[model samples]
Target: MSQALARLPGLGPRSARRAVLYLMKKRENALRPLLSALQTVAEKLSTCSICGNVDTSDPCSICTDPRRDEKSLCVVEEVSDLWALDRSRLFPGRYHVLGGRLSALDGVRPEDLTIDQLVRRVSAGGIDEVVLAMNATLEGQTTAHYVAERLEGFPIRLSQLAHGLPVGGELDYLDEGTLAQALRARRPIA
Candidate 1:
């Protein structure tokens, strides 16, 4: 049980053991529901074909929603980043999940990600703005720049999230008002 629980991210041996014990103590109410939820997700969850977001459907609700701005697409390094941006509640455009960032050391290349699909989506038409919401990490910035360069000739406005501090990342260690000021004073990437 500990081994099984430890397989989850952020759960070590000690934490897993504690979690397993807790679940065992609440077998009927907590454990059963947890197992059922896991099984349901395993059976129903699938990657969205158009944007690579997790969904039960292929194109996903965002892609199929007629109210979403088709002309604006926000490119994110991962589905987690997409979720974070969604939590911010500032964006109303569609999203493109890249899966991962470019990292030569890690053998993650441009082809390994959904770069080609993004280019195809933009080239196909209707896209006017692309907001790169990649992390502030080196690999994230590299990937963002690469995408911006690839879309240079296309008639689209490319932008990025304001950099300074955040509520979650390492920058989150900073004060709240500082992060807000950084967001307000964000500049366009040259």
Candidate 2:
């Protein structure tokens, strides 16, 4: 159990051991409820057939929500990224999870991702804009470019998430790559 818990992201061996100890000490309060919840989630949760998101419903609530803009689609590399963007609530649009980014070193490819599904979605029409919300990494950019090329010739607009310094980042502490990107993406404050 400790090894299994430690295998999870951000949870090291020490933390996993501590968690196991706590759970054992509070078995009635913590372990039982946690087990029950895990069982329920395992039994009820499923992947969304439309956008590849995990939810209790087949299409996911976001995919089925009528209030969301069907004309705009935000493509993310992972379901976690999708959750992060949705948590912000800044984008009132639909989403497409690409499963993973293109990485030749890691053996990930366009075929491994949901690029085909994305193209099919765009081909179906009603989409006006497609936001490539990939991470600021080499693989992410490569994947974004590949998706853009695949989406070429479509009437839809293509855009990418801006890469730059964080809101409270110090200029002196920043890296040159980030500074360069910030300079390149600079906009006039009208």
How close is every model to the real structure, measured as TM-score?
Answer: 0.85, 0.95
lDDT of each: 0.89, 0.95
Clashing pairs in 1: none
Question: lDDT tens string, model 1, 59-83?
Answer: 8888898888889999998888888
Largest TM-score belongs to which candidate?
A: 2
Q: 144-179 in candidate 2: lDDT tens per residue?
A: 999999999999989999898889988999999999
Q: Which ten residues in a row have the lowest lDDT in candidate 2?
A: 162-171
> Model 2 TM-score?
0.95
Distance (Å) between predicted and true CA of 62, model 2? 0.1
Off by over 4 Å in 1: 165-190
